[model samples]
Target: MSILDDLRDRGLIQQVTDEEGLEKHLNEDRVALYCGFDPTADSLHIGHLFPALMLKRFQEAGHRPIALVGGGTGMIGDPSGRNEERSLNEENVVKEWSNNIKDQLSKLIDFDDAKNGAVVVNNYDWLSQMSVIDLLRDVGKHFSVNYMLAKESVEARIEHGISFTEFTYMLLQSLDFLRLYQKENCTLQIGGSDQWGNITAGLELIRRSSQEGESAKAFGLTVPLVTKADGQKFGKTASGAIWLDEKKTSPYEFYQFWINTDDRDVIKFLKSFTFLPLEEISELEKSNTEHPEKREAHRKLAEEMTQMVHGKASLDQAVRISQALFNGDVKSLSKDEVALGFKDVPSFDLEESEKPLIDLLVEAKISSSKRQAREDIGNGAIYINDERQTDLQYNLDDKDKIDGAFTIIRRGKKKYFLIRH
Candidate 1:
């Protein structure tokens, strides 16, 4: 299948400016395409995977991919999906975020010196140098006030309020497409469905700025906005946004996010988020339908995504920790693995000593009182390091610690506690 066909099969394509023309252009030449990412945060989150991976898809199809860092546009912020106007970040902060976003993009595409190697460009390089007068004359004149206001992005914010800085954002993005088309021979721009307006604006700018007729012009495509079957948003967990950076969200945590995907969403996510072949995904889909409890699709999606975003070593570590936790083999986990497994569980810090299990349970608040703790312990309801302890005098010591850093306690089947020394 062609690249566009594959995208359609994956349900990635939402809207395209010129489907037939764009298909012919892609098939006939080594087209250059660009996707702009606004650096609103230091790290790109799970929400960014679609377009980031789309760049890789194009590169794999022998096309050049230009990952545009919105250093200039980011300062003004895109008002596409927001309910209110965004508070602008400082130049220094946006600059730092731009650099971080560049690094994140590098992880998703090949930047090696080859024919189809990806290239990273910052809009600030050109946009920052243009004077306000030059912007108004060169780019601003192309966009009419009525045309700008008609866009969904601006229209949504009209009642709440939209600032002039935000109102002029379409011009800046259009300038990006125009500049890329002129300098890099870029002919296509892609982004999320929410960016359809911006993407088309860029295409309009490309046509208006060019001396060529309809035979030669830029195009735009957008991936569908992700949604959940349960009426919740994709890429969100109880904790918050799942970031690409390991520091913001650990590999284990990220893995858990995918592994826990609702069954209804897993197969769709496997299609959209993973590079696995259609045949393999079909087999997994069949397995999922036959045995939903096994959750084969969920495991595959989690494994593929975790390995892609984090390295093999990190994915391996995450799996090791997950398996150990699941098997009740908590004692076998290393110190770092313990930290990752119990990072969010109830925890307490205490000095190491030969404290009776009942007293420790009471102190850790695993039980309401010493009497209740002793009663639970006598009934074999308390466990240390996954081992049942029925003796009321059972004491926790250094030997009970996992790698001498922490101890895991289970008050019942579902409740887990972590004690640090």
Candidate 2:
């Protein structure tokens, strides 16, 4: 199937300037397309995955994909979905963020140039050099004040007020598209549904600036805004945004996020996030309905996404940590795995003296009171490193410590505690 067809099947396509024309252009030539990402943070989060992965989809279809880093536009945040104006970041700060984003994209796209290799470009390269007079005479002259005011991005912020810097974000983005069309022969721009206005504005700038005038082949496409069935935004957790950067969110955490996908959302996510074929996905969907208890779809989604973003080694570690936790096989976990598994669980520092496991459980507050702790122990509901401890006087030793750094404790089926030496 055509890449566009694949995206449509996956429910990725939301808005397109001209569906027929885009399909013709994509099929007739080795079209070059781009998606711009603003560097608002040092690391890209899961929210940024749609466009980045979409670029990969295009490249796999034998088209050139240009990943545009919005260093210039990022300095003046786009008021696309915000109710209030954004605070401008320092020039150096935006530049640093731009660099970090570039590094992250480098891993996702194949830039080897073996066959239509991907490219990363920074808008700051050209936008930073353009003078105010040049911008006004060349690019700014094409956009009418009424036209800019009517766009959804600016219209929403009219009540609260938006600064001139942010108001001009669309123009900067348009300039990026125009520059790419002129220099790189790029004919398409894709982004999230929120960027439909900016993408179309870019198409407008390309058409007016081109000799083709109104007949320019420049087009725009946008993916649907990711939303969950539970009425919450995608890519967010109780902790906060799930960052793509491992340092910001660990591979294990990222895996856990996808592994815990809602049953209602699992099949849809598999279609959107994984490169697995439609046949395989359909089979998984059938399995999802037949054996919902197994959570096959959820596991596949987590495995595919974790491997895609974090690499094989990290995916393995995530699986190991997850399995160990599920099986209550704490001894199988390494020190780092222990830390990753119990990172958010309650933890206490032992005084480096021998303490009964029951005392430690009470001391760590895993049990509400000494009576409950004793009762839990005697009932064989307490576990020290996955081994049931029925003896009320069981004491923790250095051997019980995983790597001499931590000990995992389980009080009953659900509660877990960590003890650090």
Q: Go through the candidates in order and give each one's C-alpha lDDT.
A: 0.91, 0.90
For all predicted structures, in order, the TM-scores are 0.98, 0.97
Q: Which is the leading candidate under TM-score?
A: 1
Over 211-232, each residue of candidate 2 has an lDDT whose tens digit, in order, gives 9999888899999988899989
| lDDT for each residue of candidate 1 in 221-321, tens digit (9 for 90 to 100) | 99999999999988888899999999999999999999999988988999898999998999999999999988889999999999999989999999999
For model 2 the TM-score comes to 0.97
For model 2, the run of ten residues with the poorest summed lDDT:
110-119
Cα-based lDDT at residue 71, candidate 2: 94
Candidate 1 accuracy as TM-score = 0.98
Model 2 error, position 201 (Å): 0.9
Error of 2 at 225 (Å): 0.6
Residue ranges of candidate 1 with Cα displaced over 4 Å: none
